[model samples]
Target: MATYIISSFRNHNKHVTYTSLISTSVNHTQILEEFHKFQYMQTKVFVVHGSPSISSRLFSMAKDVGMMSEGYTWIVTSKTTNFLKFMDSKAIESMQGAVGFKSYFPKSSKFHGLKHFMGLKEVDYDGMWAYDAVYALAMAVERLQTKKHVTKLALLDHILRTTFRGLGGEFKFVNERTLLRPIEVKNVIGKGDKRVGFSIVNGEFVKKMGKTNSSTNNGLEHIVFPGGHTSILNHRRLQVNGKKMRILVPVFGGFKNILQMVVDPKTNLSNVSGFCGDVFNVAFNVLNHKVDIEFVPYLFEEGRTFNDLIDKVYYKEFDAAVGDITITSNRSRYVDFTLPYSDMGVGTLVRNADKSIWIFLSPLNADLWFTSAGFFLFLGFVIWVIEHRTNEEFQGSTTQQIGTTLWFAFSTLVYAHREKLESNLSRFVVTVWVFVVLVLTSSYTATLSSLLTVQQIALKGGSVQFQGISPVKAAVYNNVKLNEDVLVELRSADDYAKALRNGRVGAIIDEILYIKSVLALYSRHEFSLVATSSTTNGFGFVFQKGSTLAKDISTQIAKLREDGTLKALEDKWLERQSSIMSNDFPAVSPNILNLYGLRGLFLISGVSMAFALLVSMVYLAREKCQGRSKMEMLRRVSKICPTPSTCTR
Candidate 1:
């Protein structure tokens, strides 16, 4: 029995066949050593058998030995009916019988002979080897690595590439469809007597062990698959002769908050089962259905930047790319892009600042404050006039009246002094108040007014409005600060317009229609138009440049758009955000825009006025301390103060 088992493991069969039966006391090492010799000779048929060893362990040992020896291999398991009875009593005595061995395989005597062998089921072996064989054939054909079966390697190569479903696995060349079959696991069971056993429990092969699968007495579990790991090996057909082609796509980027890098698993772009993966799958389906081509992703490292990856693709190392890439003319000139898969625009990502929408409304921003200030200013001026008008208006000792009037004017400007002085005002003085209010108000308005000699240049303080364009441009302009890429740059509309006028920038970008209109108004003599490429695509496919695939893909893209599929995706990703008032808005209050605009205005005004008053007081005090006449101080004041003129808006 030992000699028979050894012969079985030593390539005794001309055809590749494996049997599970093995005899007790067979030399396992000798069997492996002999098998290795057969493998060196490129012998494809060999059996690996070990008596008293579990089938799994024997197979594993055989695989390792065969791989090292460069040969195709098969494995056979031992069948033992009365395992306890077969336990060598002499060997047990030699080992002092203090130990016992529990085999990982079933101890049923019915599981014997060639029929009960581990790999006797051809299905198991076929599945296990199909993937590897297919991949080997494809690689060999691609590299032209074949023996001279024919006069030239071309005939074999053609055969290899064209042969589909030649192996156990399902295969398709034209459609790029493969047998996506799952591996089945079978559990062996014993029959009534010794010489008969069958696989009883049928289950699918699982990569992971679940909590629900309980332990056996030996605390060991077996993984059984119809086709072992080898079944799903890399089997792909090149199919060069057909019109159909395969395209490679590259992906990159990191979405931190949206999807976790590690925890959520799917958030990582490189994850084959992630969101990006789903996107690739969809793109593949679209491309494959339309043109009978296959889309394979050159999946590699994924991060926030893809410059290095683009370098690879641009060099023709990869076919194309689809992930997060900022589209620009420079990239377009080098590589072709389908319309934009999605929009890439800037948005306000407010952190801690107040974000109220009400602040955006202009009038409500200062209606209350202006009303109160004006009311008090009117009251205070009237009261002051009444108190001193009895003696006569502007007729008091000029020095004292001037100082009092200055204080009244400054106080009214700073605070609501009018509300405090209403009690002192008389009816006749109120008539004079109307003229005073008109004269003072005219000098301060920021209009096309020539009323004030100072000609106040009201620098537009942070109210971004480019009449015809959308807010997205403003947000992008504020965020993007270009460094040194010469072929492309992002600039604000104002900067772009300036550049265009100055003949600095090649082109000014806006909405296509908007830019066209602006360019129409300009003379042809100023700028020569070269080319116009879409920088940000709303909906497009990406493909290899100059390839007819792009045109075909464009048709499909249009189809998807017309059917509202594109719109649905847009709504799903972009427009699906909750209302602005939702919790995701922000923790801070929302009045910051108005507050920012108002606070800046008031701060500048207050500081300027305060400094002017300080300078005036200094000049007066200096004249007095230096014993100069009051006339000198008056001269300085007249030099500093401006004569009022026509008001502007």
Candidate 2:
């Protein structure tokens, strides 16, 4: 009955938490071991089941552990109470003070005499029910004789609706459903179940009905609890009169919003805020309890790591340690931990490559540049040889000839080599050279323009100096590879950024999840992150190794996670979690028509246009001077003048 009530309580929106479920199929030792697995939940409320023998051993075990007291509540079920039919010394000795209820108790005078005559110590409700069922069947058979036909289904239907006032209260079957009956509540005292109270059909336990505060005994005998106590024990809140709970909080810094330590100016009281505190607060509220939490800064004490802080709980220094305390195997050995509330891991924060004036050259490798240069030289050489003798513009002294050859070869780049081809071979070679230059220049100009237009270029290889210590440093080594490997030891994230800006450290290795907050905290858009290392553990509340509050707190945490409270806390503090692990660079598209790329074209056009204007003016002036025919002057201006074979040598 206790198990049913407790289990039903859990189903009522999980009003309670059952930490462990032990089956009777297991051996005696396994059962005890299973019980041992649940530690000090501060307040112990045990629901014992199984036969009298099992209950005897379990109560013996509970008694050995000091669980038999007023602070504890041990309620057994009908099976346990029924096991007490004989009330042997062993059963009574182990179950001296327990509470249980029996389903029914037959109270007929004839049945009572028969029980007494048969050496039966208690009411025979089971016998009475069986006897009633037999008489009812006999009555049905007698009625069957009156009917034309007798059917078992009809008899069963008649039996199902049968009603009577028998040993069991208002014995009735309505549509195959038994009418609701109240279970008698009893206290195990002096080898028998003593009626201390009764459970009503409406689900209320009346310990003493119609009693006031003025009544000394509340109209009931003094009830005894196992281990001989009269007050309820609560494991969560210690035995203080609602005083402030001393919660040992970690003083370490740099977990951006999850935990922050502060001192009240007016009261000088240290307060803890952030996701951890919020989660604890919410969990406590869900459990319908509260503790006046006083954040005690103890992790700040000299010569202490987080393990030492966990030790405080193991030694019962304070109620619990609240912070981003990770749950690990080593830690579990010393102190109990609640279920993990936050997922965390290792990540890296690094300075991106610096952008410089010549950053425009980043798109192409040296091979491409060298190859383009060699190809241009080859084209110039090929054009010079093809145009030298036939074209007049290529005829000059040795130095002039070399200059004109180079000029003729290079000037075809923008279709500005004005000397017309005299030979078809020279025109063919020039046409092909111009086409090659067009493609090369067009591609080069497009690429360079893209490189320049981007306001910021993501830096890479040989520039960043990684700095962090230990497993994180090791993680960085595994996750990131540098061109110039120089890992330095650094302090805080601010130091990391300062180092990057001042050209010191290139990157900082830390938990990626934490570094994300750092990036958002500082708004370091220039920085880049490359993280892949998985974090081994998560944050949880801590408790004494045997503390049962660990189970209760864990249950509440699981509940919080299920109902989105945990997620909401994460969202509240870590709202700006960075996505730098993506490592995506801005997509660079070629800008072919930018003014910088077309500067040479503009210069050449202006110079050529100026020359044409000068020549047209000169031709018009000469025409006016000689009073020559306009058509002759126009032809003179358009004609290509022949070069002297060797420049006046």
Residue 282's lDDT within candidate 2 is: 81
Candidate 1, residues 1-649, lDDT tens digits: the string is 4455556335532222223343444477755765554433223333333343443334445445534122122322333222323444432222110111111222224323323665453323333345436564575566554554544556444544554333333332333323233222222212111221122122222322232234442222332211222221111111212334444444322221111122234653233223223344454566554334444454444432334545554555444555434455555665666654443332221111123464223222365347435544544443454455444443468687666655665454434334223322233333334343343343233321221211111112222212222223433354433222322333233343555454444333333322322233333333222222333443233444443345555565567667877545533443323222222222221221233444444444344434444554565578677766667787776666644332221
Q: How many backbone clashes can be found in candidate 2?
A: 18
By summed lDDT, the worst window of 10 consecutive residues in model 2 runs over 462-471
C-alpha lDDT (0 to 100) for residue 84 of candidate 2: 67
Which candidate number has the best TM-score? 2
Candidate 1's C-alpha lDDT? 0.37
